[model samples]
Target: MKRIGKWKDRLAAYVDGTSGEKLDQGVICRDDQCTLGKWIYGEGLAQTGNLPTFHQVKAKHAEFHVNAGQVVEAVQSGHQDNAHKMLHEGSFAKSSRDV
Candidate 1:
C-alpha cells in the first residue's frame, strides 16, 4: 500500500470537504499543509478567489493525477501513443518540445 504523507492527508481532507477549517479569505499561508492544499486545489492567482467546491476539486484531482500517472507509466513502458492520448484527453497543451 502507498504510504500517504501529511500533504496527501491534508489534500484528502480539503478535497473531501472534511477539513473543518474555513477557506482562508486571503492567500493560502506558506505552511506545508497550505502549500500542498493549493496544489490539490489546482494552481491559480491568489487574487482571483474563485475556488471550486470540495467535490469538484476532488474529482479533478483524481482525474488529472491518476491520468497523469498512467501517462508516465505508459511512456516508461514504451507506449507513447497511450501517453499522448491521455495528455490530449486531459486537455494538457503539449508544446513543440513535448512532442
Candidate 2:
C-alpha cells in the first residue's frame, strides 16, 4: 500500500498549482485519517461544517499540505461539475451517499 507520506507529497503538489484549490479539497491535518475521504484520526472526523462534501488533499510541487476552508467553499460555491469530477476521480467521494 502507498504510505500517507507519499500521498501527502502528491497532495501538496496538486494543491500548490491546480484548480484543486477552487475545489474545496480541505486540509490534511495530523489526524490519523483524512477529513475529506476517510477519517482515520482515531477520534473521528473534523466535522465538515456546512459544506455538502468531504475535504480533499492535494499537491502542486513540493509537499502536500492542508487547505481546509477553501475546499469547503468550493463545494458551497455550487460547482457540482468540478465537485463531481473530483469526487468520481478520488476515494474521497466514492459512495453516492458520501458527498
Candidate 3:
C-alpha cells in the first residue's frame, strides 16, 4: 500500500511537471517482484490458497501490476496527460482500488 502511494507520488509529480523519476516498467510489470506481491504469491498463498477470496486478491494484484506498467509506459513516453488519466480514473486506478 505504501509502495503504491510512493508510485502515486512519482506519477503525480510527473503529471505536474515537477519531477522526473524514471520508473522501470520491467519491474512494475512483475506482480511477484514487489514486497506485498511476493507475500501474496508466497506465504500468503500457502496459507490462504483454500479461501475463496485469496485467488481474487491475487488476480487483482496481478492486474494492478499490468495497469501500473502501462501507466509507467505512458509517463516514459511523454504522454503526461494520458498518464494522469490512467493513474486517476482508468484501469490503473480501478486495479489499485481492487487490489
Candidate 4:
C-alpha cells in the first residue's frame, strides 16, 4: 500500500502515460457526432476503444474526445490543451476558479 502510494506520488506523469493505448490518428466528432454538451450536462457518455468510433460511447468518451482532439491539435499546432482526457474519471476538469 505504501509502495503503491509512493509510486503514485513519485511518477504521476509516467504512470498516466502507460494507462492508455496510443493511436496514429484521433477521432473527431462532426455534425451529429459531437456531444460535448451532453457529456458536460450528464445526458450521455463518451468512451473510446482500439477500433474507430464516431460518437460518444460511455462516460469516458468525453475524455477520449478531449484527449484525442488535443493530440491532433497539438500535432498540427505544436500545443496541447490545458485539459487532457485520457480515461473515465481520470482527472477532474479544472474549475473556473482554477483558471
Model 3 lDDT tens row, 1-99: 777778677767866678867678998889999888889989998999899899898899899899889888887888878989998999888987787
Candidate 2, after superposition: displacement of residue 16 in Å? 27
lDDT of 4 by residue, 6-68 (tens): 323322332244434333334432212444445434443234333244343333444444544
lDDT to native, each model: 0.41, 0.35, 0.85, 0.35
Q: What is the TM-score of each predicted model, taking all chains together? A: 0.39, 0.24, 0.86, 0.26
Q: For each predicted model, how many residue pairs clash, with residues at least 3 apart or on different chains?
A: 0, 22, 0, 5
Q: For model 1, how does the per-residue alpha-carbon lDDT over 1-99 read when each residue is reduced to its tens digit? A: 122244334433443446674434122222223343465445533533364664454454444444434544554566666656645543322211121
- When sorted by TM-score, best at the front, the candidate numbers are 3, 1, 4, 2
Task: Choose 1 or 4, whichever is better by TM-score.
Answer: 1
Q: Where is the poorest 10-residue window by lDDT in model 4? A: 90-99
Write model 2 residue lDDT over 1-99, tens digit each, in one string: 244444434433444444453333443422333442334232223454333332332221112223222223345676545544543454333322221
For every candidate, C-alpha RMSD to the true structure in Å? 15.0, 14.3, 1.6, 12.2
Candidate 1 global lDDT: 0.41
lDDT comparing candidate 2 with the true structure:
0.35
Q: How does model 4 score by TM-score?
A: 0.26
- Indicate the worst ten consecutive residues by lDDT in candidate 1: 90-99
Please identify which of the two predictions, 1 or 2, would achieve the higher TM-score against the true structure. Answer: 1
**Which has the greatest lDDT?**
3
Name the regions of candidate 3 deviating beyond 4 angstroms: none
**In candidate 2, residue 36 scores what lDDT?**
24
